[model samples]
Every structure is written in C-alpha cells, then in structure tokens.
Target: MFYLPALLISGVPLKEKIVLRKLTTLTMLLWLPLTAQAFCGFYVAKADTSLYNQASQVVIVRKEDKTVLSLMNDYQGDLKDFALVIPVPQVLQQGQIHIGDAKLFEHLDNFSAPRLVEYHDQDPCQPMVAYAMAPGSDAMTKYKSDRIADRKGLGVTVEAEYTVGEYDIVILSAKESDGLETWLTSNGYKIPPGASVALEPYIKQGLKFFVAKVNLAEQSKTQLKFLRPLQFAFESPKFMLPIRLGMINAKGPQELIVYALTEKGRVEANNYQTIKLPSNLDIPVFVKNEFSDFYKAMFDVQVNKHKLSAVFTEYFWNMGWCDPCAAEPLAPAELKQLGVFWLSPEQFSGAGLPVQITRMHLRYTADSFPEDLMFQETGDTQNFQGRYVLRHPWQGKPEQCEAAQTYFKQLHERHVQEAKTLAELTGWDLANIRQKMDLKDQSSTQTQDKQWWKSLW
Candidate 1:
C-alpha cells in the first residue's frame, strides 16, 4: 500500500474551498498512475521523488468532456493499470511548453561563413564602357554656363571605337569643339608648329586618334608555356607575328571582338589582319587551371582567319643544392625532381611572329644546409647574368656577342675560390671536391649555353 502526505490546509477560508478542491483533484490525477502500478505488482522505486520519471509514458485528457488521462510506468506489461481522469480548464490547451536551454540557437548562428555569388554571361564580346573626368577640366556648373554663348547651342557626345592588330588603335569623335580640342592637346595629340594644316578638317570635326602596335606571335597561349622557357622557331614563309591578346570577347560562337588600341594608346579598328591555321595539324596546348573556363569560352572563335597557330609547349627549370668546392654546379637530377615553376603568359615568352628575344634575364639562388661547405659559401652570390647572341648560321665569327669572354673568365675565378673555401670548412679533400663540382658545373653550363644559330641545310 502507498501512503499519501497529509494536506496542510489549516486556516483556509470557506470561500476558497472550490480552489482547494481543484488543487486536490489535480494532485490526485498526477498520482493515479503510480497508485495503479503499485496494485499491479509494479514497484514505485525511487532514490529521490524530486526526479521526475520522464521515461514513463504520459497522456493528457480534458476532464470536463469526460476524456480519459492514462499515464504509464517505465515497465509496461500484460497487467492492466487504472486510468486517471482529472478536470482541467479548457484554457490549458492553448499554452505551449518549452524544454532545454535557450543558448543553443546563438551557437548555430556564429558558425556560418560569408557566401560569394559569381556572375557570368555566355556572350564574351560584351563591350566595356567607362566615363572618366577629364584631368584639368573644371566641373561644369550652371554659374559658368553663360561664359560662352555656344554652350546653349553646343551638344556633344564622345564615341570611341577599337580594333585588333599589331597594336591597339582607337578613334575618338565628338560634335562639340571645346571638349574635343581640350582632350586632344592634353592627351599629346597636338599638331607640330608650322606643319601643314591638312589634318585641320579632321581635328575641327572634333576627332582624336591614338595607335599602339605589338608583336602577337610571341605570347604564350596555353599552360605549357607557363611551365618553362619556350624556344620559338619562326619557319613561316611570310613574316607572321604572334600577338598577345588581352580582354578578348566572344560576342558569338563565330565572332571574336578584341579591343585594338593604337601606339598612342587610342582605340581604333579600321584595319584588321585575319589568318587561318591549318585544320589538319593538331598542336598540344596547356593553360593554367584558373584560366580553363576563359579559354573554353574562346575556343570556338575562328582561328583560321587569324592565320596563326597557337601551340602550348612544356617548359621547366630546376635548382638544387650546389657545392662550390665540388667540380660541378648542383641542379635537379631530372626535370621531374626539380622544383617546377610556372609563369603567366606575359612572362613566358615574347609576342609576335618571328619572335626575337632582344633581352633575356635569369637569376639563380642556391642554399646548402651545413653539410656541404662549398654550397654554403656560394649562397651569398645571388645574381649571375648571361645573355644569348644570335648570329646567322654561316657567319665564321658572329658579329653579335653577349658579355665578353673576360666576363666569363671572371665568373669562373669566383666559382673556384668559393669552392676552395667550402672544401676547407667541410674537411673534404680539395682534389675530390674540385672534380665533383667541376662536372656538375659543366653540365649546367652546357645546358644553358646559347650559341649562334646553326642551319640544318
């Protein structure tokens, strides 16, 4: 049998009896399931009654409507338990019950990162238009509007058109004279003093022009060009130059529009050169992953009309530990083992057909971690310069020469002295170190040495 605690209702007023009765009913309703379970041989086990047995099943019903409220114990069995029927106000159904702590929501909001939205359009040939404030021109103000009576009658709009070629060219035209002449003189388009006035008609009509020409064939077209230095042999019967194209637009699958500017950096497209490449030839090409999407968008543009073949060639260089005391300079044993470097299209090669590399610059850095004395001594020699001299194949003694032989002799002496110092510090035999360093140095030198062009004919 279960015992019920005595009620502490002393000194209660008679008028409050109805409220007391309702509380008594609710208490009885909450205990009904435990009472029935006790009678059914289910034990009411508890270390502390303050801990509610949440695992137990509970059912709530409306008492005024004669509905049943059945609460179950943790161990439900074949034996039937008594049902608790209690009266509850209809308003209790409208309230909500919340569980758990409120801080969980704040943690979730803090973990999210900013998101980026990318915008791209299928048409590649979209023109870029911009209006910039003229450098020395004052802002137009209503106060000064009457300075020139022509201001009321003058209406001006400047139009700039560009096209592609050896250089970019631009033509600027406007209907107003003040702005046109101001723009031309400020941009270095002023006519020479005492020169013939044949250009007067064009200038008076508010026209300005600029031109920029560049070699196109020497530009890198693919990823392979970035991996290493490229050697270009222009065997074309006609002088065809390679040009590096910037900001090209694929207006349509067949139409590619590139902004052509003149040498004076003006937009002009009056003349265009179109050449078509041989469809039968397949040339390997490479481009960085970052530019993959850009190239894909431009692949359909007609290449044959440009009369140019764009091929991607793999180029690479390597540097490793070198011992100045040893006979040879140190480099990667194989191209694959070396630290591979990549360059952008502009950095990879020159642009233009029959590309001529007028200037070549190379820098090498070496590091030796204590083990090799020769390598350690040479680490401070940061810059070693060399250049290629191009001459006709049959020229007995090429007229063109880079750094004289005296420069090479000086470089050789520096290497030898550095190697000797390293040998003394590392406790390596001078003879052995010299032999090894010499072989390595010779191999490296041979690989990079440039000589006059020799014809195979």
Candidate 2:
C-alpha cells in the first residue's frame, strides 16, 4: 500500500504519534487503488515552457488512437514562465491531444507538416489530439507498438488534438484536392464534412493579404527639373580651381549639364575696355534616369598638354621660396648705424635639386654666425661682407656610410611592401611598377610615404 510520504523525527513522541495515525488511515483508504489500478490505462498531458511564456503556443497529440481530449488557450500566464507537468487522466485507456497557439503551430508547419493538422480551416483554432501515455505510466515499454507512422509524401493526412483552456480541439490535415471524407478516414478521425465547425471570422481576418498598395505621392517631390547651363573657369597656367556650374531650385530626377569654358575677352565698343569672356563652349546635357547611370555618364575633361604643363610650372614656382643672401640691406639708417642690418641673397643657380636642401642650412644656422664673419672694414667705414657656404662632402667611414645606405634601402623596401599590402587590400594597383599611381595630392603622397617609412622598425 502506497500513500504520499510523511516525515517522522526521533525523540518527538507526540508528533510521531499523530503522523502514525494519519499514515494508517491513508493506507486503509487509498492503498487499494494504488496497488490494483496500476494496470489501468490513462493518457498524460505535458506542457512546455514555450506554452508557458507568451512567446509561442503549443499543441499536444496522442501518438496512437487519435482522440481529442482538451484545449488550453492563452496558456501564457503573467510570469511568462512555463513548466512541463504530465496530467494523468482518470480514464487511463483514453487517448488525447494538445494544441499550441496559432504562432507556434504555423512555425511548426515549416519543420514537419504531416505532424500538425488544422481544424475548421482556422489557423489558431482548436488543435486536434491523439493517443499519448499516462503520467509515470511506463507506456514507453508496455505500449511500444502504438507509435504513429512516418509517411513521406508531398502531403499526408494526420489527426491532431490540442487542449486550450478547457476546450477540446480536433483537426485533420490532408492535401488540398482531397475531400474531407478521405482525409478523416486516412487519419482515423472521421467527422463528416457537414458536421465540421465553420472557420472563425478572426482567423480569416488574420490571414495576410499577399498584395499591398504603395503610395506614389511621397516620390513626387523627388522629380527633378533641368535649368540653364552655368559657366565658370579654371584659370590658365594655374588650374587649381575647378570649373563650377551653379544650379538653383533643383529637385529630383537629377540631370547633368557639362559645358567647357573657352577663355575670351569682352570688349566695350565706346570705351575700348576689354573684359574677359568665355566662348565656343561645347556642352553635353542629359537627364539621369537611374542612380548607377548618372555616375557612369560623368567623364573628366583633361586640359590640353600645353595648358597642363604651364599650370604645373606656375603652381611649382608659387610654392618655391628661397632666401637670397646677396640682396642689399633694406633696414632704416638708425638700424644700419647700430649694426643690426641683415641681407638675403637675391639669386640661386640650381635646377632639379630638391628644395628642402636649400632651406635647411640657413634655417638651422641663421642666428649662430659670428659678427666678424658678416662685417669687414673698408678704410674708415664698415661694409657688409657676409659669406655663405654650403658643404655636404661625405667624410665618414665606409662602413658607416654603408649602414646609412642599408637603412635607406630597407626603408625603400618597406615602402614597397606597404604599397603591395595596400594594393592587395583595396584591389587598387597602388605600386605596380608598370602603372602610374594616382595620388590624391602632394600632401597625401608625403603622408603615405612617411607612414610606410616609419613601419620599417
């Protein structure tokens, strides 16, 4: 005879005596069924945490002798937690089913279709039920022959049951063309087509509409219009400024107007005042119909060879600033009398040499010259007599010079490696010996060169 366990402590006679009395009564009253009804048949209902939380719903089914027993609805409680508990039925031999909420059932459709069935063509309708073992019933060993068939086909009929809040959900699944009779008979759950319940209105309304309407009104403002061409110029012999075309009140449907400005002079008939004007401009105009199409249509206008060289030379000269120590002093007489005058040379005789070398020596030693070296006496008067000397003769050990040369060679190799890496990373031929590199500007080129050199160590 078995009853719910009770605890007894040693040396507690009074509490032990009360427990003994309750245990004797429970044994006499409940022990008979515990022993004799162990062989009786029953079905068990197990709930999953997915069924407990509000995230998803579940459907349970008996694996054999499909029979719907109960339906549980909105099982997701306030705590958003769930536990699996097997509820044993008094009639142990009966089979039952459980149905999850609408969302979970639909999700299961993607994994295994034959295992789930719909009732009344309703997505969230009552889930059908089938045979399942009773709680702690050892049915896995005793009823081994009751497993369902694993039929493989495009579609197959199955009986499923769900328990939703005290309701019994029964469903049958089959292919679309098969009549209800064939489906019900195949799955062993036969409810006449006329007896089936109609689908709920809410279920029908929940079906998503495949076709959607998009409003074009929001896109209307994106429509762009073209305006008259505007002209500007990049000054000759120094084309640093880019030619610009001004657009006003431009909207969408973007269009491009490219016009080449020809340098010309405007003349006033009466005053003979000549003003510069642009002429003979050949402009291409087109509307861009697509995002990709617009960028592809753009092309660079290369200035003529003569124009480019002239611009390059002018730009280089403007950047050149060399000190001329031969130039006469320009200080005030008071400053000259005080021997505070300094003069700069007015001429240089080198070409193709790096400009950095010319500025280095003067910048480093301008304030360190001796006063006697810069001044000389002519009879009774003092005259300016400064002499500038530039010397860079190699005068170190051969090994020392070899070390410096090796250092520079290593730096150059590192630059080559970095260029190779950049080329590989960006798929741009940054250092291909045969190809001309397209540097952004002189500063960018210097930065890249410096960074590559610094990485050698």
Candidate 3:
C-alpha cells in the first residue's frame, strides 16, 4: 500500500495535425504524434492512472519560481486519521492556500495518459501512406491553539495555521529533526518512524513544513462525500517534490502520475534519469480490449528492467486541442481552477489555452529513491506519448488485384513480426501469442512464401 505517496502534475493540449511516420523500431519506446499534418491516424484509446492500484496524482502549474500546486489522493479510511506533511521552501500565507476540484485531475490524466491508435494499411498500391497518433477531496478542520513550547524547548515554531475548506492547515519551522518529530507526535499526529532522519536535511536547508489534518465540522459543512484536492501557491527557486517523507509510511513502492503545466514547454526530472516508457509498438488487435492489463504488465516489466530508479515521461504536448482525444481537453475555466494562475480569460476562448502539458510517471521505494524528486522545465516541446499501435491489416482478399495478392504474402510476414514484437514488449510467451494470433500451425518456409505460388494472382 503506497497510499502515503506524494506527487504533482497538470497540463493542457489541443489537437493540431502534423506530419508523422511509421515507427518501425523493434522494442524502442517513442512518443506518437496526436494528429498528423501529413501522416496521422485517429487516436483511439489511452492508458490512464485507473490502471494502477495505489497511485497518487499531483498537478503543478509553474512559471519561474512561482508555482501553484494541487494534491489529490483517495483516502478511503477515516477522514479523522488522514494527515499530510510536506516540506516547502517558504511559509505559505492565508491567500496562498486553496481547495480545488478533483475533476481537474481526471481531465489532465485523460489528456496526458499514454494512448493507443489504429491505422488500417491502405491498399499496398495506394499512392500515399498515413499514420495515427494516440493520447480527491478531504475534509476541513479549524485551527485554534497558539504556539506551544515542547519538551527541552526544542525549537519547533508554528509559523502559521489556517482552516482551508475541510482541512486544518499548519505551517511549521523546526530547528532540530528530533524535536520536530517529538513535537508532532506529542500533538497527536502520527509521525512515521524514521521521519526524523528524513526531516534532518530539509530542516538544514531551512525549509518549512506544511501540515494538514481533517476538520470534521468544516468537512460536514462542505456536504461532499469525499475529500477535495488542496492547492497552494508559492514562489521559490527550487522546483522539486518532497518524496522522502512518503517512503516512511508506505508499505511498498509508491506509484505516481504527474501532470505538469508549464508556460513554455515540457518538464522533466533534473535530479533523476528521466526515461520515456516503451511506446509505439505494433501489437495485435486483441490488445484493444485488454489495454489496461497489457499496460500494467508492460510497465512492470520495464520497471524491473530499469531497476526502478528512473522516472518516465509518458506524454508531452501543447494544450490547444487533441487530434482524436481520449477525453476532451480541460476547459480554460477548469485550468484556472487547478491553479493555472497565468491563464487569462482571453486565452481561454480564442485559440484555446497556450499552456503545454507534460505527463510523467514513476514508481519508487525507499531503497530506490533516497532523495526528493527534482524537476526542470525543458526547452523541448516535441509531442510524445506512451502510445501503442495496432495496424488493422487491409482485409482485401487475394482476388481483388495483384496488389491484394502481394499484400497477403507480406501480411503473414507482418503478422509473424507483430507477434514477435508483442512477445518482446510484454515478455509473454511466444507460443501463447502465436496461439492467440492463430499462427500456431504455420511453418517457417510456408510463412516465408515457399507457397507464394499458391497465392499467385
């Protein structure tokens, strides 16, 4: 249960037709263009965060040191026991905190999730070719108590506190990690073991802690069944997320999907290796129905292959529109609600929002990620997604024309090739894929056209 994970992300995209090419690489993962100016296909399906069991979602809207961050999670337990502590660069004032809508997170995830696209091969004799592209709330509490001295006068200052929505927010600054740990524990917040050790470096760096617990009365007043997301706006030079604290309480590796909204271009991890997930592989059409299972299996395989140390960029695109949107792009109004401070009313109506979106996914345990996640917005704005391809072979029969006969000969070869690629991508048994593809009885020479004469037109 990695329910204790911390994460952040948010972005926007609009569809624009651009040129594309058939990705022929064996197992290499690459981003697929959403709409092709020259060679694009209809975007069909997408792999969203719902595929993962214990994933956390975050949205980050940033311009320079200034950032608006929203945090959402599915805390199915008692709201009374839910508490969150995150390290920030500075103390947040009353105006900086907000409560956000959860639908904003869903919209971003749909727009940025890795997708599936299909292209039926045109008649082999066709003049040109085409390609395709694919793409929580908590209660509130009230704050009343004043600053109180702790054991040994350990310097833990309650810098600020506020009742925001259903949360009772407290900002703290501490001089020593042990004192901070003791103070939090004494106050009835369950400080996870080894948290003091993780808090040391942040305290030394002069960071402030933003703590929140549920306020039953405020929550009941909201009249919502679940917790809404918490948003905070701040300006700081550090572009990073505090994850070390999450490791203290998680039972296993935590999963995260980040939707980063930047004014200029894509965002990536600056401190860790940022790798793109394996994408744009040609697989059998059977995958369309089982995309979720396939994606999880493929992701698990890649995580093990990478030893779980790297972060992955799943999608990065400009947020004006989508070619064949898996879900509609978030409206400018929704973007503003998610804390896109720079977005203005004019931009929302005209050419859509100018903001770009970057979707990053990562999984880590305490052992794999020892430090917090650090990120930097990149100048690269090239479109990319964790996209899978399913080429529905042209169904023209051998009697159609000479091209049809030729196509059938090559189609078998392509089918065999597709099978092999699927096996490699998912590490599935070749025999099983062949069985599923109905290629179990075909011989090498026969498949290689030893019987080419049988199909001669």
In terms of lDDT, model 2 sits at: 0.19
Let me know the TM-score candidate 1 reaches against the reference structure. Answer: 0.13
Candidate 2 has its poorest 10 consecutive residues by lDDT at 357-366
Candidates' lDDT values, in order?
0.20, 0.19, 0.69
CA lDDT, candidate 2, residue 436: 31
List CA RMSD, all candidates: 44.2, 47.0, 12.0
Model 3 agreement with the true structure over 1-457: per-residue lDDT tens digits: 0111112122322221222221111011122111111000000011211111144677888988889888776454566666677888899999999998776675676666666666567666652443333331111221111223345587998889899999888899999999888888777665656779988998999999888878889999988877788899999888887777767656666776678898888899988889888776788877766666577677778888888898988888777765445556777888888877788876753234578888887877778887788899989977777777677777668777877777877788788888888888788898998898887457774665666566554
Error of 2 at 374 (Å): 82
lDDT per residue as tens, model 1, 1-457? 0111122334332221100000111121233232212110112111112211111211111111222222222222211111111111121111111111111111111111001111111111212212111112111111000001112222322232222211122333344445443443343433222212322333453333222211133212321111111111111122111111100110111111111101111111112322211111111111111122212222223232222222110100112221111111112121111111122223322121111101010010111110100100011222111111111111122232332333443344444554554343333466765674452455555544543132212
Candidate 3 vs. true structure, TM-score: 0.81
TM-score of each candidate?
0.13, 0.13, 0.81
Best candidate (score: lDDT): 3
| Candidate 3 lDDT for residue 189 | 62
